[model samples]
Target: MSIKSALAKPFAKIIYKKVQKWANNPVDTQKKVFEELIAQGASTAFGQDHDFVSINNHSDFVKRVPVRDYEALKPYVERVVAGEPDVLWKGKPLYFAKTSGTTSGAKYIPLTKESMPNHVEAARNAILLYINETGNAKFVDGKMIFLQGSPELKEQNGIQLGRLSGIVAHYVPKYLQKNRMPSWETNCIDDWETKVDAVVEETLPENMTVISGIPSWVQMYFEKIQQKTGKAVGDVFKNFNLFIFGGVNYEPYRAKFENLIGRKVDSIELYPASEGFFAYQDKQNERGMLLLLNSGIFYEFIKADEFFTENPKRLTIKDVEVGVNYVMIISSNAGLWGYNLGDTIQFTSTKPYRVIVSGRIKHFISAFGEHVIGKEVEQAMQEATEGTDIRVSEFTVAPQITPEEGLPYHEWFIEFENEPQDFSALAKKLDNSLQKQNSYYYDLIVGKVLQPLKINSVKKGGFQAYMKSQGKLGGQNKIPRLSNDRKIVEGIPQ
Candidate 1:
């Protein structure tokens, strides 16, 4: 075996041991993590405001701290941005992860010394766990390319500010750094098109064995590589064996990716956010990712249906049931107290605690009370396009509430790489698939409350153009699959 593979084997073994232990007693481990966080931050302003000193258990913590979204937590975040010490965590944060927000134009999430390690360690452990479980260490013998945000972090009030992916790039382990592609200089290019061109030049000649990034951006890189080298990705990186991805659902893009790469490679999903690294796909056979219960974050789940209510029923891991969608609330060592990250998830398995991201809470189509979510739309699209001579590059669905010529209906703007033979039949199939997945949608259609869905073919690169306009074209930025309003639909070119 190569020296790199030999070194990775031992590390993977150790991580597997720890992961097995954590899985054995998840609830107790989580409780201990919560207590430690409370004890560590009890002296901070946020801690004192929430009465953390007297909080002795999960129930007490829940009673004391109310769940809040980004808007509600802005005051404390503002203090942190102003360089205030101990406003949330023990001291001023080392950095802030800049992310898009709903109410606010931008959000600056604190990343303290204590919380930063969680992101780094969890990411490392995820890869190690995958290697341990699959017995695949050859990939480590060669370089791995990660398409991420620009690493040129801007200093804001003495704290570094950048995308979470960029911040994490700064902390990649030294050993792995040697095998990581696209030099720091290339990664810092603010313009994605320029950065990708540089990455293609830097990595096309390397002995690359793994590729990791958001699926959309990675797909872009794959296309660029193929265009430049006149070869499929598999041919360019003959030993490539793994593809690590997150930020968006991979199902819809799976077929397109397979065609681009020329062969299927092993893949693992991660649920990482600016807030925390919540879960990772630990087992090859598992359908959902294992929630990181002891990863320095206390978690709570509120039913998605009741999330907008004044007092939604909050449930612990023990109380959550499989198949029910829940909005995840987290109290992390980063000093966020009961902060709702706004992504909805459903537990696929509750024993070892595994979950699939259902959708963003705000990115759903429920105009006529059908309550169609991200997962449902993804599944419908998959079913509708299956076994057809059609390939969709990207798509978004929105309610056309005020149609000039027809009844109110849901309209889908689809950018197809390979158009279907029959557009009318494809639209009918999509509507039928939606009815099968959502009972409420079917009822609405049957009762003549809503018209059949409409399909609008978008010009090639329309979605990309729309994303670029929003300044969200690359890493961690995804087109919302469904929207209640026509913002996304109207923005795309027909």
Candidate 2:
């Protein structure tokens, strides 16, 4: 092993033990984080306004602080942005993670001194855990690239503000600086397509071993490399073995990725957001990511089915069950309290507190009351296309409430890399898979309230054209797997 790989083995073990201490005591770990957060929050203006001093337990917290999304909490965030101290947390935030969401405008999530380390450490620990689990530290010795937003940041209220990945870029460990690919200038090239082209050129001659990014963007890179080198990515970088990805599920892109690489590469999934880094895949072979119970954030869950109803009951680590879709709520050291993350997750293992992000709570189709979630649709797609040569490039689902003829149906806009032999048969198989996963959808189809879902073939690059039109063409921007409204997919040609 190279010097770096040799050193990584022992270091990874230490992190594994540290992570295990919290994982083994999941409930207590979270409770302690909760207690510490409440204590710090008591000093903030929001805490004082919400009676945080009186809150001694989760029940008290629940009664005092109701869940609030960005809009509901905007007033306090506005104050913080205008340079107010002791407003949200104990002091002014160290930085603001600027994110694009909520119709109002950009959301500036606080990243305090106390909370920033968790973001850096959680990502570090994920790789360390992988090394410890599989004894695969050799990849650390080779050039690694994380396709991310520009490291360039802007100033806001004397605090740095930028994309989360950009902020995190400043923290890349010194040991890996030489190994990380795509020079700073290439990364700073604001245009994603241009940056990727630059990345392809910069990485082409290196001994690249690890590649990381959202799957869609990475696929673009892979295609670019293939076009220039006229070789499978594996041939271009024979040592490349690990693909670390986040922001979306990888299964849908698995076949296409394997095809691009010309072989399967091990992958690690992470659940990260502008608010906080929550979970990461800790094992080479596992169903879900290891939730960071001992991180600065404390988690809460409410069943997705009842999330829209009056006062949905919140459950802590002690109460969640496997396989149930629950909307994830969080309180964190970043000074966000009772914050609705709007992401739905399902616990795959409660003992070690592992979770898989199922979907965004808002990104689902229930116009016909079937409540088909991202997870269900993804699962259906995976099952339907299994054991087939059909490869999907990108896809999204929207309800077609009005059709030119016949009953209205759910429209699936698919950009296929390799189309199936029979589109009609594929549609039936997809419908069957979805029916097996959701009874309400099954009932709707049986009742003839909705016709069988129809698949619309989107010509190659159609989705890319649509995303580029919206100015969301890369770097953590991805079309939703499904939407309640047709706004997102409306621009797509079908």
Candidate 3:
């Protein structure tokens, strides 16, 4: 191995060993790890705001900590960015990652020297575990193409830090430094006209291997390539390898990608949000993903219903039962101590720590008292349209409280692979599939909720057009596959 490889490989091995051992009880191991890290100034106890005196003691260490969301953290993050040793933690933040919020405007997440390691370790473990399983250490035969956000740093107080994209780019291994697509000074916030063409042109001549990014941007590039070259992306790229995507699911866009590229694309589910990296696709099916427990986080799971409450029942990884859906909470070294992200997850197994994301606790519309989740809707759509050209690209279901006929109705907007002969029959079949999957919806349809599922057809690239217009076309911004509001659902094209 070269000197660079020699240095990185041993450290990677040590981290991998710890991850392998912690997969069994990721929550407990993380709790202990975070406690030690807190004592080292890397983190803080969550209950320190109210029960600081008591939480500082040893006996109450493992008890649950009160959960908080990003809005509650605004003041503290502001102070950190302003170089003040704010509320709980002490340190001048080295950088702040900019992420969008539902209502708090935009969030400037502080990333100090003490906090950056968590992000790096999470990203590193993702690759290390992949290497251990596939035994493919040198997967990048040519340059590894990262379809990422603009590399330009937004400077605040003479310190350079803006987005996760800029921070990650700054920290890439020196050996692979030259392989980056967009140069550091390029204005990513500018229109796609300024950057996309050059990025495609530069990489075409090299030994391009793994292509990584959000599914939409990659699809955008694929489309752009087709327009420019007068040839499908498959013909242009002589040796296109693995297609690793994160941020969102590729199921809706997969067929078009494959049809044009003429290659089977292997995907890695990247469940990362502005908060942190959650889980990844299984490199080996049965083993699931070797979740990065030690990468700067202490984890906990709560019953989805327990979220948004002052007192919630939280479970450690050891207490996690198989085949049950739960909400995810974390205490990370990045200073989010005992934060509830509100995303829901399902445990596939416990021994090796395997899971599949079920839905979002906040992503439901029980306006008629029928509790419906994103996963149920997705599964129902998949089942209802089995073996039909009427595949849904994106969809949403929300309750309409005020109806002309005196009942609330569930509304849906569906994108298709091909036009259906009888869209009305397709709509009824979709309603049936939903009713079968969720008894709550079935009851609502019969008595309370509403009747006659309302359906609409969206034009191609309708979702993409909406996202681009919102200036949320890249980074953690994703086209929401499932939602629970008719107003939000109507925003997409028909």
Candidate 4:
């Protein structure tokens, strides 16, 4: 091992001990974070609005603050965007982690001076814990590549705004700067395909040992390397041993990746979002990522099935049980109050609090774990027929898990008031629109794991007929806009 890896080994041990102290007392650690959040919140506009001064404990908090999605939280976020200070948290956010939303065009999640370190530290600790456990730090000395968005940031008022990964690029620990690749110029390339091309050019000859990104994008990188060198990626970068990824499960693409690399390498899974860096894989052999209890975020859980029900029971960490699906809610120091994070997760272990991402709370199709949600399909459908005379009558989308021909696809059963001039062109529009909105779907499409979506023209009254058959069809009942399986689609009149 070189000097950097040699030094990281001892440092890794110190981090492990510190992490264990909190992990072992999960509930108490969460309580401390909650108290800190409430104490700090008492000084803010939101705290005054919600009567946070009267909140004595968890029960009081739940009563004072109801759960809210981005739309509900927009009022405060708007005030912050307009240069207001202390509207949500103690002060104006240092940066806004911009993300795409369903109803809202763009969302600006706050990163306060206090909460920003949680994201960077959680990522670093994940690697260090691995080093401490396996006695493997050799990868630290070689080149590391994080495939991500353009680091170019825009300023609003006095606060910087960018994609979470782009904002994170500015905060890469000083120690890793020498090992990290490709150059900043390549990282700032805006277009995905163009950036991948530039990254390959810069990284091909380096002593690359660690690669990080969403699995689909990283697969693109692997494929590009093979095309250039006509060799497996592992052979091309003999020292590459670590694959760090988040956002989507790697299982569906594992075989394809291993085939591309010619061998399996150690992998670490992280559960991160624009809202917060929530969890990371602390143990290699573990079933789930360890929930971050001490990261200045207090978490709540509501049973997924009951989330739509009025006044569903909100659960604290101590009340969470293994194997039950729950919508993870959070109140963080970042100024978000009782925010609905849109993720559904199942706890795998309660003692140290570990969870596996299950799916989104409402209208999600994850047959291949791509997490195609209702909003994405709606946006795509709207975009596809925006200026065209062709109008939609009724429609629903479902995953085609096993097609008789080649790879799988999202099957669109659409009833058109006026059909497209060319059916194939319309399908392409739908496919392109969906891919543009969702990065995971884009990756799947480009990686050849899923084909471009296919649209089946439904008989004009098909949706109504299906809805009638299923129920006492009336004003209240309607055809689901999207389903993961073909149950609803199969029943539609052909």
Candidate 5:
């Protein structure tokens, strides 16, 4: 190893040791650490003064300050980019992590140097936990493709540099930096089409072994690479052993990925956000991803259905119940307190603090009065095609409103792996599967008052090409899996 890497190896080891200690600790002990962090964050105006004092010491203190969204911090971001110190906090922002808010198109989240350690620690914990579970320390060896966002900073505009992916990139251990696929310029989150092409050209020769990215982007890239070479991407990177997918579930593209690669890749699910790297797949293969409790964030869960209710019950690490869906709220070292991130999850076990991703809180279609969550849709899709020779390459469901009907109807666009022997039978089975699985959907199916579910098949590679056209390539970004409005879903052609 180079001297620099040799030096970093030990430093990385030290960090990993600290993370391993945290990961293997009891849930109660981790909870205590998070509680202390929340208390510290709430009591102090951290970025404002660049000082960590109790909230009581701050002058503009309200008894109970309400949670503020990205709009509340826009002025601070503008000032920070203008070279003003202490614009949001006391010191210059180390970087801005770009996030997509429900209301905001793109948001620049500020991060300071002090909080940078948390990002590193969270990632380290994820890697170390993988090693502990699989006994593989060479995970970083060979080529590891990170489906990343645009790394370029917005100089003169509203959104600035220092995206979450970029901020994390700035802090990656030096040893791993050399192995990151795609050039820094091409790894950007924006400008997806060009970046996708750039990554394909650069990484093709590295003899990559691990592919890590959002499922949709990866699927798109796989298709794009295949189209360019007239051969499958897996055929090119035949040595690829593991697929580390995060930001979204790979269930939709699971079989297709395996087929494209011509091998069963060891898959790892990572739960990370612009705010924090929260959970990772450590054991039980694909069962439940373990929460990184000690990595600078405290987590709270409320009943998924009760989220908007006035009196919703919250569950801490100590109080989590298995098998029930709960909405996730996070308090991070980055200064977000009691934040309802709007994602839902289910606890599979409290003993190991393992949980499964249920769905997004707001990503439901409630027009029919039957609340259909991401989990239910995912399960229904899996069941509808189970044991069938046909495979769904890509799919999306949207609630459409027709002038003839007051209520909305579901429109499904699915691409099958092969020409169905009986297309009508397949469609009928899909409708029945959905109705039987989801109550709200069942009502629509039985009533027949709404338009019947429509399924359309497009030519292969159509979805990937469409995604590239929209500039949403790579990392943490994908076509919306579920949307209340049909326009956005329909926008994803084929």
Candidate 6:
């Protein structure tokens, strides 16, 4: 074996040991994480404001720190951004991860020195855990091509600001750096289309063993590689065996990827965001990701159905049940106290704690009280296209609420790479699949309260064009799948 592979084997063993310990006793791991975070930030302004010193357990902590969203935490974040020390965490943050916002223009999330390791470690351990579980460590001997955002971080009040992926790229492990691509110069390109071309030029001929990125961008890279080489991705990189993906659901794009690669390869899913790395797919036999209970974040869950109510029931890991969607609330070493992450997740297992991201709380459609979310829409789309030749490039759903439309109906704007023979049948199947998934939707259709779903076949590249128009074409930018209003649907071209 080469010197790098020889060194990595021992490190992999150590990480696997740690993963085994965490997996064996997740409840204890969670309690320890909660205590450590509270103790670490006990002297910060937020900690004092929330009575963090007096908090001894999960119940006490929850009672002291009320649930809050980004809007509620903006004041404290402003202080941190303005170079205030010990404002949120123990000291000033190393950088701020700037994420796209809805009502607000942008969200600047603090990334402290203490908390940065959690992000890096969680990601590293995810790969290590996979390696341990599958006995596939040879990939480390080759290069890893990570499709990330611009690495050119902007500074504000002495605090660096950039996309989370870009921020993390700066801290990639030294060992991996030797075999990582594309170059930092290529990654610093602000334009995604331009950046992808540069990345392809740099890494297309390298001995790439692993590829990691959002599905859409990676698909573009795969297409470019095929166009340049005139060969399948599998043929180009014979050793490429792993694809690590996050930022969006991979189900819709799985077939397209398989078609591009010409064969199936092992894959891993991660639940990382600007907020934190929450979970990773640890077991091939399991469906959901293993929740990172021991990470520097303490988690709470409020039932998604009750999140908008006057008083919602908040539950910890101890009380979270399988099969129920919950809005994730987190308190972390990064100084976010009871911050609502705005994402909904459903527990698939409780003993070792596994979860599946259901959807975004803000990205749901309930216009006629028949609530539907991203997961439901994605699943329905998958079901609708099953055994058919159709492939959805991108899609969004919106309520056509105006009476001038004759009947209230849900309109689906879909961009297809491979069009199905029967568009009407596809729409009917999607509607029927949704009805089966959501009882409220089923009741509405059965009572004739709502008309059948309408599918608007969007022109190719319409969604991409819409994203570009919004100035959010790549890297963590995704079209919200469901909306109560027509903002997203109206923006797309048929």
Candidate closest to the true structure, highest lDDT: 2
> What is the C-alpha lDDT profile of model 3 across 67-185, one tens digit per residue?
67777766666666665553445555677788777787887776666667666657666766665556555444346777666667777764566668657777787667765555554
For each candidate, what TM-score against the reference? 0.97, 0.99, 0.86, 0.77, 0.82, 0.96
Q: Over the stretch 230-305, how does candidate 2's per-residue lDDT look in tens digits?
A: 9999999999999999999999999999999999888889989989999999987779999988889999999999
- Per-residue lDDT tens digits of candidate 5, residues 80-121? 666665444445656667676656677766566656686677
Best candidate per TM-score, number?
2
Clashing pairs in 6: none
lDDT of 4 by residue, 285-341 (tens): 989999999999999999976888999999999999998878999999899999999
What does the lDDT read for residue 254 in candidate 6? 85
lDDT of predicted model 3 = 0.66
Candidate 2 has its poorest 10 consecutive residues by lDDT at 98-107
What are the root-mean-square deviations of the candidates from the true structure over C-alphas?
Answer: 1.3, 0.8, 3.6, 12.9, 4.7, 1.6
RMSD of 2: 0.8
Candidate 4, position 30, lDDT: 89
- Stretches of candidate 5 exceeding 4 Å from the true structure: 1-27, 46-92, 137-139, 154-160, 188-190, 228-231, 284-286, 403-408, 417-419, 443-452, 458-475
The ten-residue window of minimal lDDT in model 4 covers 471-480
Clashing residue pairs for model 2: none
Native-vs-model 4 lDDT? 0.85
Ranking by TM-score: 2, 1, 6, 3, 5, 4
In angstroms, the error of model 5 at 375 is: 1.5
Q: Could you tell me the C-alpha RMSD of candidate 4 in Å?
A: 12.9
